[model samples]
Target: MLKKDKERNDAFLAIGNIANSVKSAIAPYLDGVLIYVREGLSVQSRKRGSVNPVFDCISRLAVAVGQTLSKYMEALLDPIFACDLTPKLTQALVDMGFYIPPVKPTIQERLLDMLSMVLCGEPFKPLGAPQPNTLNSVPIIPKDAKDP
Candidate 1:
């Protein structure tokens, strides 16, 4: 019912922080936490006080949940940016979980060697390698075969 109110953003964050503190214990109720958060940041709750707390709450929940927050990113971002999206707040959210660290280009490059071995069992050929030739279309000739 907290979502129905939309004005009690501070209260929503209070519950959110509690959820963060006992993360796994509240796993089943995580969606409700996000629901209230989204509601608090909704356009209807445009009060400066309400919006900022929601941002802080979002960042805290993100840190607590890690990549699990990624699934709700779209829902969270819409209302968040719809309110008072500042660079600092956005950065906080990204730092916590929005842009996962492993997906970064640096991480991929760092893992290229290990990933190649694990995924393909061998390194791929270089770009300069000659194009592979095919033999399926060629017919075999025997030494004893007479010419037509």
Candidate 2:
């Protein structure tokens, strides 16, 4: 059990590291966007509010960040699903009753669902509970669900 715990911890750390790395990579882009917005706002104020350049820049930056993070998250999900450590983690969660049956999804399914939830900025509700209002705009069903 000790060894299993260590493996689970390692896997969790690996996933966290990947998320941190992606965030770190985007930090410079975020900083540049902020600087541009600030400059634009200052210029607009000097020009007596005749221009709204800051909002445009902010919107573009937000879109770029969303796209980048979406790609990163999609890429991250596959490996996480395939990792040997995941099933063990899921089993442990189940054993502790953190994951309820009837609605118990496979490891891969759970991982994909989690990634989608995070990307959509939704709270991580377990499978059986009511999904939060934040997910109203995003589709929560699995892609494969439509087929079978």
Query: How do the predictions measure up, each by TM-score?
Result: 0.53, 0.23
Backbone clash count, each prediction separately? 0, 0
Q: Clashing residue pairs, candidate 1? A: none
- Provide the lDDT at 103 for model 1: 31
Q: Against the true structure, whose lDDT is highest?
A: 1
lDDT of 2 by residue, 1-148 (tens): 1124344334334433443456445545554434433443343332443212323322333333443433233333343333333343344323322322322244346655666665776635556986556857677876786686
Runs off by more than 4 Å, candidate 2: 1-27, 43-49, 67-148
What's the lDDT for residue 11 in model 1? 74
The CA lDDT of each predicted structure is 0.59, 0.39
Candidate 1 per-residue lDDT over residues 1-148, each given as its tens digit: 3443444755756865875687657656668777877766666666534466667776666666666666676566545544433664555555554444533343234234444666788654556977567796567878766666
